[model samples]
Target: MASRTTQILEAAARLVARRGVRGLRVEELATEAGVSTGLIYYHFKDRTGILRHTLEFINDRAERYTTSHMADAAPLAPRAELEEVLLLELQDAPEVRENSAAWGELRASAVFDEVLREDLARATLVWAQEVAALLGRVTPMAPAPALAAAGERLTALLEGLSMRWLSGGLELGHARDLLLGAIDAELARLQGK
Candidate 1:
């Protein structure tokens, strides 16, 4: 069984995804998790606490999943590692989709909520750094600045495409294709091809 903390975090993700951050209520979250409101408070402190923790939890989960997957596919080329990290969130699994949805919500809400901006920015940069590191591995000869720029571009495109996909504004196949194309183009540019 999932630990109570994990259960609460999962419920928080679901609630955040279904209702925007502003709409998430403690009572609703408790009911969703089959836990008391006090448990939620004990674990997270408050709504802002819940939002912060959920954001971290979802991002951590994604990172862990990508790491495990890459480990399983050991001996993969740098390009393959980069591709997996970028595309893993697009998987059709229920958990991936839910996490993506909640992530999108938290990201969108951060613009208006000061409490979430710092954590959101931190998470965003962490993802970009992961992409940057992978890009550096793939293009060992490329200058650091160039690799960083490419990583930023790719990460930005992935996040934008994901948000659009979640909103039904873009098809899954198209989003995946666009991301892949962007990755290819960026790498080609970095490689001076």
Candidate 2:
């Protein structure tokens, strides 16, 4: 069974995703979780605690999902490897999509909440590091600086694709093609060096 804290966090995340964080209330989250409002306070000291826990939970799941997808693949060329990883990242895991929406709502609310902003920045750094590691493994020919630059570019592309997909700005197929093409072009440029 899920712990009370986990249940509360999941409930809060769903509520925040559907209706901005500003609309989230402790009583509502507790009710959604099928617990008493006092139970929430028992698990979390306050609203900020709940939000922080939810962000950490989302980040942990993302790391696990990305790592699992990248592990145990057959060795391939840098271009092929990059394409594979991009495809995996671009495909929206339902859990991730919901968590991402919740995070987006938190991000907008974070403009006025320093704690939320800091939590988000920390989570972003963890994600960027994971992306950098994946890029580094593929770009062995490139120097550290060059590989790092590529990683940053790849991160940007992934983020952009995610935002576009979530906002219904682009179809998944189009985004995949665009990302694959960009990765292939970059790999070719590296190969020529």
Candidate 3:
């Protein structure tokens, strides 16, 4: 039940994920979404508009997905919430895998594109803040340096491990274990244990 804009965004995301942004063409995107090139321009204005909207579309989807999952598990303990949030990153479903790959592609593309760089940095910052809040809630310390450092560490581990997972180098269960282990170790360090 997605709208036309969502349909176009999804198509564009798949194309970008598969071939990178440099490979995206209006005709190809139109054909992929079963819309005319005019419709694409009408919805997004131009190539840059389409690209910006596509990135925002993907970011919004991630935020919604994370929010939904976190909300569903809100009754759980702080550690469980932390586990749910981080483990949600490694989804085995086809759509999730596509999005994960697309995310990696977008992150890579952002290095050379200033606009994308800003957007991607904003997305990462939001996610990191969420992780920091979770770390603060789960750890013995307050939302101070301990939580900030632990959250950053967890975010780095998630990004690195997500790359490995997306490349088929790690399974979801293994990634979950590794994340939990890291979280536990980080908590221990925070507690001076």
Query: Which one wins on lDDT?
Result: 1
Error of 3 at 163 (Å): 1.5
**Deviation in angstroms for 13 in model 3?**
1.9
Q: Model 1, which residues run further than 4 Å from truth?
A: 1-6, 37-49, 59-73
List model 3 lDDT by residue over 1-193, tens digit each.
9899999999999897777778889899999999999999889889989988887778777766655665664688988888878877777877877777778877876787787777677777777778888877876556477777778889888888888987779987898799989988988787773
Model 1 residue 119 distance off true place after TM-score fit, in angstroms:
2.1
Report the poorest 10 consecutive residues by lDDT, candidate 3. Answer: 65-74
lDDT of candidate 2 over 1-193, digit per residue (tens): 9877788877887787766667778888888999999988888888888877776665566556666765667678645666676676566777666765765665566678676676667666665666556666666666766666666777677777867877899898898888888777766666577
Better of 2 and 3 by lDDT: 3
Summed backbone clashes in each candidate are 0, 0, 0
Candidate 2 or 1, higher TM-score: 1
Candidate 1 lDDT, 41-106, residue by residue in tens: 888777878878887776677556545654565687889878978898777778778878887887
Q: Distance (Å) between predicted and true CA of 61, model 2?
A: 3.1
Candidate 3: segments with Cα more than 4 A from true spot? 1-3, 23-25
